[model samples]
Target: MPQRTVDTVIFDLGGVIMSNGKPSDFASRFPEADRERVIEIIMGPYGQDSDHPWHRVERGEITMEECRSLNRDAIIESGIMPILSTMQPQGQESSSTGGISFNFSLSEPMVQLIHELRDNDFRIGVLTNNVREFREWWWPLMDFETVFDTVVDSSEVGLRKPNPAIYHLTMDRLGATPSRTAFLDDLQSNVDAASALGMHGIRVDDDPSAAIAQTRLLVQL
Candidate 1:
């Protein structure tokens, strides 16, 4: 076990604190045809292309409407005209109770751990890489300002994780030093980035309860 030098703790929202109710979760919202079409689109050229509109959506450069238009165009280019009506309905799912809902409500153990950390006077932050369109729903659930001393969203900052600048921005915003911070992320790439920056990075994954226990042990909390 690593010795505790952790003065700050940073968490990633999606897949860490909350689930990413993305295409899979939204699938039931659409008609069978639309769902099949969407699956095809995701598994085809659009998925292969880094410059796909989905990337634009992820980077916050495009609005949902713009992305939808772009996706519709992509489908057309693929020699299929996607039924926009079906797609529209899928996008109408409520933000609050969608597939992306936080599971922590059922994981009381994790919730208590979070409260314990806060009570122990640790500085905490929430950093997430997310599409801007879902902010209205996701942000309120995370309650960044209430649970964390600082919040870093890639959509708002234009720099996503695995990117050192985003990490620097978080540090700068919180006036924290990398050496004193412990970063938790479900992604190894993000964890590696934080570790490279001289921060303690814990990869939180399946059996996150064990991971959390390990984390508490790491920081000697």
Candidate 2:
């Protein structure tokens, strides 16, 4: 197949355009708990769309409160609740009953890049596996309506990342084909999925400069 020039760029919300809020990032809050185990119980195999409470919440199949209840129960049963309790009191301001905060900040660098892409006429879109309740928290971070051609929230659409359908949906909404699109995500699995569909996938790390540079190169900005 002939090469296609990139015209569309898709971004993942958390850890990409926004500061980190992944399971690992949350796990770090509980220094007393096993980080890997904490991440597993909280996120429940994020690389795949499963019946895990976290995944269900992301798909809008269940409410965040319900998922939190479920996760709390699991933590209690696993004997980690006590450790978490020592960190913070119950009913405190937290993303979950486990007291892990979901607080995140917008990445100014990524925001600037989005503006640059828009100025250069590249179609921009956001595909995020986000919670419905947390929409209010992230929406105000950016003028999304003006910046993005489309914003596909997993909670709104019942599909999440690493699931090929969502990628196709974003591409369809952007009126861009896979070969002519570039996707940036913090998760390697998500990036790999986009690459599998023929889109240029760029993984954003702690320092987004590398991913930003890669994206500019791919789109020849």
Candidate 3:
């Protein structure tokens, strides 16, 4: 079968391109119900919504330093620290900002995959719910100019994943419509949001191979 032709491809940054120490990743640290409870506190209302402080940090509404301080204080005040204590790895240090350390790293073949797409003349764009502080560390790791046509960071734009507005902002900036662009994210909720808005949404979990495979199938790359 002839490959479907796509001009624009949007990639999610965190889980898709890099790893982050997410609270959910420590589920084994707590007992079943306890882990669920901790996760609920961490995510809060509107899970991953702009209203969340973590989202605020992503939008540049607060500095990472401040966020860390606030999160620790809140956890302490709320008595969440005791539970988290059990989850903390021995000798493992939490981020100075009082959260798990999450930095962007180029996932091996995923980097190659992006290059392959670019080499094939696919216009690539990045859409990420990222903090402003990330740019200080993330850019030096990879040559983004060589890889993507545009990037929309939530901290820079004040919009985030699962929000229809943020996706529209990216598509408009990339000058792409939903059908013409393929969107890959590590979260189903985000993929669903993109799909709802007409983008070809490919959902994956932490693994970029799923995204790579889906992209190949979608565009016959």
**Per-candidate count of clashing residue pairs (backbone under 3 Å):** 0, 0, 1
Provide the lowest-lDDT 10-residue window in model 1. 97-106
For candidate 3, what is the TM-score?
Answer: 0.80
Candidate 2 regions with alpha-carbon error over 4 angstroms? 1-4, 81-102
**Residue 72 of model 2: what lDDT?**
81
lDDT of model number 1 = 0.66
lDDT of 1 by residue, 1-221 (tens): 44557778888876566644334434443445466566556423322224566655655777656666677766666565333333234435544322232222223455566778889888888887666766765665545678788878877877676778888999888788999888887767678889999988998774578768877886788
Clashing pairs in 3: 68-97
* Residue 152 displacement in candidate 3 (angstroms): 0.5
| Model 2 per-residue lDDT at 50 | 92
Off by over 4 Å in 1: 1-4, 19-52, 71-108
**Ranking according to TM-score, highest score first:** 2, 3, 1
TM-score of each: 0.70, 0.89, 0.80
Clashing pairs in 2: none
lDDT of each: 0.66, 0.85, 0.72
Q: How accurate is candidate 2 locally (lDDT)?
A: 0.85
Which candidate number would show the highest TM-score if scored against the true structure?
2
Least lDDT summed over 10 consecutive residues: which range in candidate 2? 81-90
